[model samples]
Target chain A: MTTQQEFTDYQIDALKELANIGMGRAGAKLSQVFEHRVTLNVPNVAMVDEDKFNSLALKFETGSPIVNIIQQSFIGEIEGRSAFIIGGHNFADLVNILGYEEYDAIDEGHQKEMLMDISNAVNSACLSGLAEQLELDIELTNPSIAAFNTPNSALKDFFFKQKHQETHQTLLFEIKFFIKDINLYCDNIISLKISSLENLRNALERLL
Target chain B: MVNEEQFTEFSKLLQELSSIGFIILDRRMNVIFWNRFMELHSHIKSEEILSRKLTSFFPDVNEAWLNKKIRSTLVLNNQAVTSWEHRPYLLKLPSTQYSIDDVDFMYQNCSYFPVKDSDNSTIAVGIAIYDVTEIAVSQKLLENVTEQALDLQEISTHDHLTGLFNRKFFLDQLVQDASRCRRLNWGLGIAMIDADHFKSINDTYGHQTGDDVLKELAERLQATLRTFDSLCRYGGEEFALILPNTTEQQTRQVCERLRECVDKAPIISAGREIPVTVSIGISFLSRNKSLEEIISEADAALYLAKHNGRNRVEQHQAE
Candidate 1:
């Protein structure tokens, strides 16, 4: 549960607006690259209390079965950890949708690599507001599998352990991106430090 | 020596003496720097290779793939890694280790790191390749041993002559199939098959002819049974079968069919035509019954079939 006092309604609204803009940019970039129709929806933003950090992890995985959580850290004007939570009824279905041959698609490792490829494309375009940080290279860590086929309790414990002592407050956003043509549906979750959220709010307000 | 000159010389020595290979490539796939390790393995010196398009002379380098990896590294401003299993090597070099039949070239795990300019824009990609032939060889050997172990396991559970399930495997499946039938509320039929007048055949013909008759009989009976039916060589001139999902009625039809199949033809063995027939006994799986009781019932039925006639099917009567 998020404490209502940490962020005003206006600030939360600004974060959602910022996410919508980022989603638009991501959809455009992906459609241009893949030559497929893409649909993106606005994300939900909430200020998570340090006490509720464990519960926050379960919220990200509410609609998910066992999924692969790919983590990529970004640092710049506004920094946060981005995640691609990919799970489906059948991974072979996803492999077919991605157009991998039967010789390669049936393998487990290749399936994970497929997740990484699509996740990287979305993370680069949507998360961290990467376009604004052009002058300097934003140190985006290579995507790593933070957890694989993990249960909710373990995932929550992982999220709790990743919380650093210096972090004052955390903001969580749940976003969805869909490729309409092939039904490539995926959910993304990102968390930003309160200070970075402040910087992002100021930036979005200037645009407003 | 001056301090700066000594530092420069030490850096040069480290790059040249390293066991792994290293190369730097600009955005246009032009060679920027080739370390001593690369030069020694590739046998191309600095002068001839510097600033030259790597793909121009090196046919081993996959130009299209190398560019894709480099482009991803540059665009994402992140590291790109490849395992030897996924791709054996980008630049093939002859194996320096002791000769192995399957391994003639070095296996490599390569990493591409983005090299940035003063303004933090990626201008080049630095690639590091490590030799992993030893690891690959060990993994292959391990796989071969595992496959051999599986083959050994296969041999232990089959009859040496007929290649059918042996007595031990038949017992294992009997218990498992009974429990499964009880759990699923289905019927289970057990049959004991004995070739009639088998001792006379062995005494009349040679032992080899007798063996040939058994082999041919096994093949004929096997073809007549359903795929789910399990047949095993119980002992000399005798067989046991576990027929799952078969009621008493279906069991009679199946056993009668097997009896008719063997009765129809005389098996030709070693230039001799030997007439053969089999006596079959049947029992049904009952609720809350032990496997021993079911098998004993089937055995009693076989004894009855031998008493009444030589080539017929008999069912144990319920007491």
Candidate 2:
């Protein structure tokens, strides 16, 4: 029987390569939209349990008290969720980047729309990148805001609160994006189900 | 070749007949189609706008950002939307004839999607603009009404001259605070403050100057009290202060400080300095006592301060 660590190491390198290709395209799209230089760090792909999902967030420390997270679930060839998190402190900077500062008050619906747009871009680019590489047809839903103005404690339980069908390991892809010109920072996390992991591996092997 | 002209004629009819703003742009961001609604509101004819970049005329439009929205639709085949809240007007169009007052520009909700060809390849991006002026006007009206209601509430509850709680509101708060303190088993402090010789001040100086002195005295008393303390105008140059969770000693000390605050400083009105002083009477709350009993206790102390001499702090004598 192959241990989890062995499987993780074996898949991490390939997944990293796929992530670079995927996030590179996402970054390009973001750069074009923001009219700023957006740089994405090398994505870290690892297999983690549900408990580890909360632990992983501890590695990132933001000065802001509240973390604004945009979450979207995708169900298709694979089932999983994607989240885009930004510090509350940087929300003003984001508004300026989107050229939405002219409005006196931005309504809740409008704020959700703006965040959903960003989520859609990243989720679509990342999911499609993995789908194309594995040659799997995936159906992505319209991006919806799962949580906003989340505290540290609530954000920790975000993953556990999702609808549980069966226990499956998650292939967690973590990437950081920086807009150097505006000093804006955002993190994108994509988690895939472990059962789907086997299907993805088999699909990649057939392509090989 | 024949289908091209037919498509053009169909588009022309759609543009002219539709009330919504419709415009189609190619990959290069060049205008491919501009509907009659756009022409009427923007006052830019199709002849002049054709083949021209939309952002060229509307310099405020974020061309690069808008292109990204178009690209997302083109690449992912998803619809992109912008509301009036996010971006009020993509194109600054004239307001509707029946728009609410103070609304000069049209409010718009815009949608962008990819226009596909026969091969299912996206050739151009289509933008549909909906005039949401009535919804926007109604929202503004609601906000204004809410603000006006809050303003009216403030005017009703506060003394206009001193900006402190009026007699009716002060009495209500006193009754509520006294009952709460009894239930919680905490001491409540009550102090009655009156400006010494205020009638004479108004008689010597004009009423305008008298109003200024009252305002200044209210400011001084507010500064001397803690954040949790409540001060109110108790009618005719007299004020009531309620301090919760305070002992008799603390109440006396607070009243002393308030008396000193008014006595040491002279209020300047109309560029002339006038001497001013106040007498403060302090009382502590007792269980099972009514609000009037507590107030009458403080009122007796205030009377003692006036009798002994003005500009002093006095505690209620034990019966």
Candidate 3:
């Protein structure tokens, strides 16, 4: 088994560089779609478990149901997952940007389809960049969704199962990016285990 | 191992290993070849249901419909498929194991495909059942959240009385527009308006007529202002306008037009012809001033216009 401390420093550095590049691409795409200037910022990154992830997501305190696109992949020996979260407050702006009159009578199937499309585009762009940098052929699964209505504890239950199984800690990288007129927020997170570091190092050496 | 009894046992094991449920029925609709899954799901033992007419085993099954579908499949020499939208047959499943109240069993999406022989004749109907309860529940939850969000938004952004943008929304727009102007160096104008002696109109003709007066004023303001300009109910008997890319002089002309428009028509409210007029105060963003300071100056100018005389426009002159 890979140790948690052995992977922390390297993963943090790799995540920052990866987010800087990936979010830049996402920002450009959103700017073109919304026809406005967009600002992408990566203020911080950290490796956290389920408890910390839940507490951190709650601090944002958005009024609407949190819409997230989760894309999973296996990079080397590590499991990689990236999620792009859009808060409820930004729903109308997104709807208007997509050329809808109003979100008054939006149906569930339509919302799911839209979420799936957005998640697919953003995750493909960002994760593909990460894979390119790490020099790994990462296989990605179809995106899935999760939502939170109130500040309920159940928000973290789904992600906790993986954290509890392994003694070796996972790498959790948090990135925040935004575009101006559209108010696009790309909260991208990448996670992986320590055993995958050797393959990642070999890939990086090959790239160099 | 090669004895006749052992050969028969091996054939039974081979029949049970298949994933697809295989059921053989004679022309008289006698049940035969019920697999393990079919027995478990339908709660009908092979020994008990064998040689019994399929319709007799499950009394709810429509014999006429089944006969018609079977005939069609045999004539066409192709496998006939039926979707969940069309109910194919009612199976005698264990009621305790699959309750109607259970979401999974409540909405079963099953497909019925006909099994055909080499000679292109219908042999049996294979039923494939899938549970889509989770997808349906998730879809409903998403709809509920969206509907609740829209309801909350409508309550927050609109004025209860006149259906205009409320004062809170107007302030928010002022702040947003101010920031945009600061960045782009664009000009913006703010107009403060008060209905001339609105209190006496309410006292004389009653509050109902007063409400009609407010609604009429809102409609006229909407008509007179440009589409880009936002007119909001600032408070009781007062309204405000936020005009982007408009200088003080241009805003003054807009205000003058609005003033004349209101004075020319006597508002007809609840069968009462009420003569109404309004005082207007205009202010534009100074190069260094914040939105709040500009609004205060506009309010001061409105005070000046009301003091001098009602029904006229006054431009704010910062000291």
Candidate 4:
């Protein structure tokens, strides 16, 4: 749990358990928020290096589908960011969910705003669920679109933003949410500050 | 040197007097504080807005979404920023920008900050709104100007009546294509077409009817040509065609199709059907032939077509 030490398997497993329980509540919240049936994926928890992060991103974006990313930082006992990546394929259906009567190209400004609103809801619910389990007081900052109508190449830029954090390694949580009826899906990348995450070593020991 | 209470009063005075919009709301988003600028722009006095929910005055707001943003700011204990690019404005106050257009709503950049009580629990939220309508309007004007400039540039190169490339553009394009064809050892076809008895028709029916007939003939020539063919309004009563990668045989076949179309049907002008036929001159790009020589060859063949019969097609044969 130390800044220099890598995450042990037990910690990763404990975090995965924490994520699944949190996402269960988040999926229900999302279903109500979007008025669509939401399905959650079994969360993937890993400590990633630069090379592993790129390959991991490529695995999620097969055929390099265009995507938009909205990211927000969480503060308090748990510090880091969550980037919710909405795929391009989901846009036509997402327009209806956002209450747009007809999708016009000029409505790009409004479309991005609604997308940010949706992702902000998603990030807050997931992070609060994890923070509550850790007994960590957290505050999520405003969400912003990190990239729009772009390739997943921005995924690298998302990772590098954590360079300012005082941690040698990065803890990443990958969660995929699906609205099957609308054929809409969003992949989430949640990275918590390593130092803040390691602070839970004592609590995780007893909990695990 | 102000005391603590005096300093609080002084800050309160400053907040009310500040130019930017400032509002304070309790947990339910009811207006707790409304500054002078908010009153002036919103037309709602502080006394009127206070204790009222923010959405009551601005009914267009999505209250459900606004509540979600406020709750996140409270739990996260952070200020959330909204840009004009994303939502334009949260509260649609009237714009202050001076313009020829009608009065439009103001574009705003807003922020939401959580206020905590003595016990450290979030008690209220503060919002700050900045007017950015002038910036938004200027950006929109720039986009429109750029589009108009592109349209003007396109108009300069096309014939107004036929919507085809003008004679100047045709001459420039032919020179380039002719040189490229010779360098690549490919053949380029050049054909000149003219409506027979165009002047007599203009004299009898009037210039307007002549225009209608010319436009009709241009449409027929365009339809009979291949996708790669480039048609131009070469003169007052004349049209030209440039066919890429075409040989002598292909050129003759294309000329026949263009000629047959106008010869087959009478051109209908203003619902009046008038019989019409065209004469065409066909020539192909050859080795060691200058562009001027090729053009002159086509012109001479056109004269021959007029001499043979007014409504026939003719090929330019090398001496």
Candidate 5:
């Protein structure tokens, strides 16, 4: 695992630039799907240990009436996972924009499937954009709902149980997208396996 | 990347074997691939559907919205998803499932996916359709059952003969209304009414005439009270009225109206016109008064109305 000291300012800047490009594409695609202008802004990226992921997950703990998470894993030159989390109220807002009647006929399972479709859209767009820009190829598995909670308090324990080996660092990106007109909000998180960090760094070097 | 022939072969296989409906549209929204499931559901084979605009076949589809969804998949390279809850059905295909007969059209959840070539440019967009009629039908049935249960509960709380609140329900309401009146410092009045000479009328005429007299008396008593008042069949030839937010003078006036209403009308049953009269005993709610105490006062007042004279109104005199 590489420390923060090993990566120069230029390498971090390059990675941030890649996030901007990829997230920009994701934001645009999201805007089209919802028929509303969506804005995505990521201020910083953190490289930390796997244990810290539990803490990083706190921001996504909206404590809403319902919480749904969709996580998809990708493998190729760089291997990692992307998760999309949305609060129930925000999801209801999204459902309204999608032209669904309020609480009419959708069950929990169908709601999860609908959310997974949206997750697949954003994850594939962002990852594909990053891959295309870095000239690397990554194949993604089918998106699936990873977690569902009504009270949202159980989400922290859910993340804590997914601890990995002690040898790797996790690259965590906390990003949010907004559909301002409808007052809709959602969070997207991308975490890369520590073993893939070197390969990602090598790809960044090749681009530089 | 697969060659053109290989891709075409794959598309044909997808059209042939998949149970779910699948359709592929080019940038112009022209149908390039229509699968077997689509043919079986939509009744349009690929030979006729190929190279045709999707809108021509299903004009009910919101063109502007569909164009935006397809544009996102084609240009932005992301999938667009919609469920049956939103639009119900995209193609308006008839429901083929035997489990659900009430629904005329199939419920669909559609996902539009981008198809890319070697250069990574999106050449076409594919829609994956899933039938969700079972879920929709089940939810509908559950709501219907809840409604039926509510109707049954109403039947259980009402009297079959007079179509008024039953004795048990009135007693339950008495406790709740009495407590509310005490807390809010509002006046509550209870009146016990009995049909005068009801037994002699049954013997002189018949039990059917007696039933008619009771039914007419209940209707007149209900009509004399306000909509918020509670009317219940207390027992044989006896009925009760619970009035909230009423004073002693108001209760007397209402009781007088009830007596006049029954005395003025003659209930006709089986070609016989029989006069009907009611004696009413009234009592008002007071501070620290229990439900049993209020009922006893009303019953004593009713006895006084019978003793003083038949077919009259009497108020409980607190001693």
Candidate 6:
């Protein structure tokens, strides 16, 4: 029986591998649509305690730091929260590559539709792979997005609360993928309570 | 552990769990089972719909089409799906609630799955109906908005009189092309063209004839240019062309060709053939020059062309 602390490492590695496959597939699909060669990098995985999560996120900052976030809840034998963060620099490059004429005023409704499209593609690719690998049937909720020039204030507060809570464990993974001239950077964090560790271990064990 | 009462309870729970209107039909299209969803969506209750042929109650079910789909699904043992794109059939189910003014409801998606028996023979068909009227209506609204936006953009960027890029879009392109030329180390050229004595033409002939002459000139210019060249209505009785990656000599040659083409064709307007000519000024982008400076140089060349002789091309030589 794997303990909660040990299961964090296993989940990090498993998520990294799953993200690699999913990103590779998404990159291939994007390249076909854009008619350009694409490259995707295997993600860096980390298990961060709540105390270190806030400071750790602050270390990675550049330019305007446009962040696209998607949150989903998975419920089966082992339930957890899944979040994806995409950098704004990558989004600007994508808009240019897709040949959208730069407008003086960006339509909010159009921007929301575009966010939904990108979130749907990336989230579905990554989460479906994770589900298949874990041998679990997971239901996906409608995706919601939050953006900020700086690190998300709510996420920072969430990390602070996690540190105060009895369970101070979270798995964070960062992945960088490129399509032609555009580079896409994503961060995924899977957070779960210690009580769910046994079910998570069983889910991972069935995969092997 | 399998009891008849327990099976009945499980069946009741399964029916209640479904959001879609579920109706089980026999081979003759007689309703066998009508769940609560169907009862709520369609005013017909289980007692009224059961043991009655669908056409006898609804009178809209095309027997030929329904029987064909049922026979196909039974033969293949596969589920048959109907989407709104094909609009297989419209289900007019009455609203159970009397508070709602509209009694009839529109169901967009329907599926028929063949129910088989132990002997592998088709016993019944399960029909699943989904209400997608809201989705269909919303999609149409979105399409309408997109189309209106595209139309408005097109109107804003184009000249209404002569179907060419207006002055605003032309200037925007000039700025972009100038910057691209500077970055790529390529030459960019602009030509300022004006109809010679256009006021005199309108004075001699009517303004209507002068308008015809302008329209005719626009057609000739469009026909004489290459695909890479863009011609815009710079202003009244004047037009501009932006040529990317063109040398100064090539620019002069193109302007001369356009001038000659215009001179040879006499514009026919109001049953009178009127002769017209244009003076063109050409200038090339320089490393030390701004877009405004280059345009001013072309304007000076145009002044020189008008001062000397009309119906000719003049190259801007920095004084």
Candidate with the greatest DockQ versus the true structure:
4
| iRMSD values, candidates in order | 4.6, 3.9, 19.0, 4.3, 5.0, 15.4
**Chain B alone vs. reference chain B, TM-score for every model:** 0.53, 0.52, 0.52, 0.52, 0.52, 0.52
Off by over 4 Å in 3: A8-11, A50-55, A58-78, A99-105, A148-154, A158-162, A193-195, A205-208, B1-319
TM-score of chain A of each: 0.76, 0.83, 0.72, 0.86, 0.85, 0.68
lDDT tens readout by residue for model 4, A1-208: 3453555787788888887887887777667656678776545888776677777677663233677888888887767888788875565676555444355223788668767766776777787677667666788888888888887676677667655566446788888877889767678888877766656665576566
- Which CAPRI quality tier does the interface of model 4 achieve? incorrect
User: DockQ numbers for every candidate?
Assistant: 0.06, 0.11, 0.01, 0.13, 0.10, 0.01
Model 2 clash pairs? Answer: none
Clashes of 3: 1
TM-score of 6: 0.36
Choose the strongest candidate by TM-score: 4
lDDT of 5 by residue, A41-151 (tens): 665577766556766766663447567777888899898887787776565664554444456225665466557656776677678777887778887776767776555
Q: Looking at model 5 chain A, report the run of 10 residues with the lowest lDDT sum.
A: A96-105
Candidate 1 on B60-79: residue-level lDDT in tens?
A: 66565466556656655556
What is the Cα root-mean-square deviation between model 5 and the actual structure? Answer: 17.1
Worst 10 residues of 5 chain B by lDDT: B78-87
Query: What TM value does model 3 have?
Result: 0.36
- Number of backbone clashes in candidate 5: 0
Candidate 6: tens digits of C-alpha lDDT, residues A1-208: 3343565555657756765775576556545434456554444655567556877556433223356565655566555665555564454554443333344016443344344434544444445555656666654444555553235545565446545544566554454544534444445555554555566567766664
Model 1 residue A135 lDDT score: 22
Local accuracy of candidate 6 as per-residue lDDT tens digits, B1-319: 8777997996697577447778777877788888888777667777887899887877765565466455444533445455543452446765334443443455367767778765878788888888776665567679999999988977696787888788988889899988988899998899999999999999999898888888899999989898878899999999999999888888988899999999996889998988899999989999998889998899889988998898989989876
